[model samples]
Target chain A: MNNQKIAVIDHKCANLHSVIKALEIFKIDVKICTSKTELKDIDGIILPGVGSFDPAMKNLIKQDLVDSIKNLTFSGTPLLGICLGMQLLMENSEEGSLNGIGLINGTAKMIESNEEDIKIPHMGWNNIEINDNNNSRILNGIKNNDYFYFVHSYKCIPTNNSEVAAFTKYGQKICAVIEKNNVFATQFHPEKSGIVGLKIYQNFLSFIEIGK
Target chain B: MIINKGNILLTKRIIPCLDIDKGRVVKGTSFLSLKDAGDPRELSNFYNNQGADELVFLDITASSEHRNIILDVVEKVSSEVFIPLTVGGGIRNLDDIRNLLNSGADKVSINTSAIENPDIIRKSSEEFGSQCIVVAIDAKRNNNSWSVFTHGGRVLTELDAIEWAEKVNSLGAGELLITSMDEDGQQKGYDIDLLKSIQKKVNIPIIASGGAGNLKHMLEALTIGKSDAVLAASIFHYGKYSIKEVKDYLNSENVPIRLI
Candidate 1:
């Protein structure tokens, strides 16, 4: 396979350094693309976001990166979203009044805090159960019932049932992962999930390599 | 006190708190006569490899070393260990939180600052999300109840422990790290009463800190005390009990935990 570069889109509202550090362990070329001009000559794109929804979306728009990101993913450039970045791939969010990139037909809804005796942020190591039929490429070697680090209040609800790649039971059956063609995302912070989390970044880079 | 939420059980966390002074991991008896334990990066990597759920770095000398030194430590530890890292001590403003997060810290815990200016908690949570903000409360038994203590548990405050837990939770603190001054360094066990009291009032996750002698105390904190996670320093620092030993004991007690 030829050499590949992954663009980690920096919208100025995320813990981008951790994500970059995680990806760097795989020995793959990774760059933090801050503007649309920097999106050129990249095999894959990673949208890692934190903070609130409205401000993150506003930062993306202000940097003129929304259109380029949408185009890149629409053209089948493998894109991976982490945490709030995963939430922004949907149509809208309950966290704030802002339209998402509309890459997937879903809405990022708040995890019902009153449903059970669970924490709001769901901050801990919760295991994931993958759907065997649609084994996501990003989860190539990862086993079922493996734990990943999660710190989020909202989950993505894909309008299409087939988009669900994995399920993690928090207060209820929360959507943990989504995979639609070249677009993949995880609600958990694989960067902060230890050695198992680092395997995820490695797998994604290999996936991009194979696709290239 | 273990609430099983269905077939899926949330793994109980075992956190090792490192009291860093001048970039070196230090643990003292009652926070005095500090002695070097190990290098921050080396010890952090060891704990991460030993299956520590998360790591907490409290800069005991933050006021003196200030930003650059601790930021460098945080940067090194975060790069070496991939698990969630929580940095505490000397975080006074939003920029402190921003800089720590930018330096690769997963979360920042504020104790004295949060008590002095509660707006800092709200503003930090507002700017960087509650998931990355943790409030540390140092409490000491005051007659029938516990009072909040500040400045390395030197000065006493009028704020009630239970009330402060509720207040910070309302202000958008995702987690609470409550350390018991009376139980700290006793090595008998955690302050069960303090943990039970605060756990009853807050819906957010409570990390029970101080007073861990052995694996059984850690288990008791999780079982009888009903803490979401257990934080200890000397036991792990002085080579008394390894993180794996405590986790193995908790697992044997039927507490669901992620085995490394």
Candidate 2:
């Protein structure tokens, strides 16, 4: 864990400093990778993002990081996406026109409540309901319904139910954490979720340790 | 610390606002003379340790000499305090929001500028996201209803308080930070009617600001006033009540609160 480096890819749509600061708190060796060349020599990768999907994808294309991320994930590098980054792990999103990385068999859809009372962004602290049989190492040692900070309007709907590592309810049950093979993602901001968020980061570090 | 049960997201936030003048955290009486509270970094760390849900850093110095100092404080606080941070004061344009966000602020609040040009609310929220765009409303009771005030509650705007809140929410403002000018620094309690009026109009989270004298006042803001969170300065700054004490009080009353 000490020697292994985790690259937090900067697609120019994220508050990368907060993620860096969160990683730094646990003494995790982390770097900000803006391009393909910078992605080299990293054991693990964290794709963190904010804002709309179109602009996020545009920035990734502009920085020539689209293929680099795909290649690294294809090569079995442990990849973790946070918030909009997690939404990008799907094939498509209703929030934007451009297609996502298509790493998972899913599409991101808007979170609409049956009742008019539910808010749009689903902002604030929400708990996670872990999938019992997904075998998600990302949620290892975590409780069944531990709360994490979330702020997003769209949610990913996986084609295969097995990919759902965790689900959280806003208006309906939305995919909160998805895990498939080497790739893992969360729809919550672990960096902003306080102690439990740090614990989530620590669990990610443990994955790096197991790989090493 | 988040404790969630079922569909009810039961966590009422307690945010400690650090009013920064120049570089040091300062507090003023009726928005007049100021006195130092402590170093921003040290005070933030203390609050974070005491289980504060979030922190707000307001650059109280209305001058150009100390422009970049708050950014440094925000950067320092963001690194040490692992909670959501909202930065406000003198935020006028997209570049200002970008700079603050780049410096590690989770949210950037716009007050005077948002009222002057409401388009900035749409533009900034589109540029960033609704989650990070906070519109701070300083309202004073004007006859029948509250009126919007700008320039640190000095300049009064013709815009009605309730109308302004609805307008901003429609224009992509994620959250509303409503500060009652009448109740500010009075320490009696939050303007319950003011909070309730805005909360009814907008679906977004409302952070009740201004007066907060005791634990019961905060409870009223969360309960009767229906505010999502409560923001305060003097009560926490002068050691009248610790963050832990407040949380304990709220928790005892069955007001879903996160205790660290």
Candidate 3:
């Protein structure tokens, strides 16, 4: 069926350069899917995004692809959601009145600062502290304090603590990477993160080499 | 002459403007042509290593009424490269400015607030020092003079671009990133006349942007416009040229730059 190994859910968000470029670096082939009609034969998936929850989820609904995502996770495909994509992994979001894919039981909340109120849509690069026991092959060659790019004000606070794989602080310990069994997601853009980020794509490539 | 590969600070930086929307690198082709480009961390790192000199990630989109993509873009890039990073958009008071600086950015650029509240220039300079705070002015030529545009070039403010440049200089802005909105993404060439006007107005290092099409465009921005630096987008993002090649041309022509 000419099934590509990776599928990047387009969903009308910009910045696929990071994901596409990273996958290219690792020699991993990726197929873009802004709709459900295109994701059927993909071996593994990467939901890369940047934008609001409501509109993004709306796009997903518009394409009627939410169920397909849920079904794919159950079928044991490795799925990784980046940044806003990570927020979409949750059940609901406060940013724009919308419900996420509900892959993980959590609510996306704003990071509160003790200072004279921190400017959000928290901009700039910071450190990520990995904190999970997930043995998923996606993180096989990963390390701690490996910096990844971030650009969001809201984060997914997993209702199920076991869902979190990593986190970074912006006046709060927000969820960074969430892995629930075969479905995994990261709030950071590994594509834009240089070397360490390259390793992530490499690992993902090896994890979902399209066998299952 | 395109020698240094990823020396973003050197090659007349061809920064791809990332207007972060909902935590993604929203590609606004004509300034509002919003399209998702994947993740910021991956894109910024790729651009940095791929030969983009510094990156400007604007958070507020000209108004504070929407979402911010600062922490997300920052946390991703700094971990990826050792390149210089400048963040702007929706920066209001001094606190917002300082927070960005402390977050691993080499500099912070301010626009709307600088015009709305002139005090911001002085206060940010006093605390973070002039070099850390970059005053970003987005302008469009109006009638006989150059007029400043605020909020992503959506509003035409009463401030004159050159006059604001001079005042921004006096307020201790370490550098000035002046974007010519009328010429942005046109890829014809730089706004030499406008840059020349500002060059005569302010002494701070200027990053001339808008209409950088080819090597000659960058050369014109530096030699004719007398701008200290040049910035562009399409040429780099589309792989038309490399930063190393641009800097090589500049250095070959005796234009001093940070060669790595």
Collision count for each candidate, in order: 0, 0, 50
- Candidate 2 C-alpha lDDT tens digits along B134-218: 9999999988799999999899989999999999999999999999999888899999999988888998999999999999999
**In model 3, which regions exceed 4 Å deviation?**
A1-4, B1-53, B56-135, B138-260
- CA lDDT, every prediction? 0.87, 0.88, 0.71
Q: Which candidate leads in lDDT?
A: 2
In model 1, where do residues sit more than 4 Å from their true spots? Answer: B2-6, B62-67
Of candidate 3 chain B, the 10-residue stretch with the lowest lDDT total is B2-11
Across B1-260, the per-residue lDDT of candidate 1 in tens digits comes to 65453554478899999998878889887776678899999899989889999999998885554546888999888877899999998888998888898898989999999989999989998888888889999999888899999988888999999999999999999899989898887898899999999888888888999899988888888888888899999989888988899888888788888887
In model 1, the Cα lDDT at residue B148 comes to: 95
DockQ agreement of candidate 3 with the native complex = 0.02
lDDT of 3 by residue, B14-121 (tens): 455566765666655548666665677877766766555467776744445443457556655664554557888777787776566546565788988889988888
Clashing pairs in 2: none
Candidate 2 lDDT at A117 equals 44
Q: Could you say which candidate leads in DockQ?
A: 1
Task: Tell me which of candidates 1 and 3 scores higher on TM-score.
Answer: 1
Docking quality level of the chain pair in candidate 3: incorrect
DockQ list for all candidates: 0.80, 0.63, 0.02
Give TM per candidate: 0.96, 0.95, 0.52
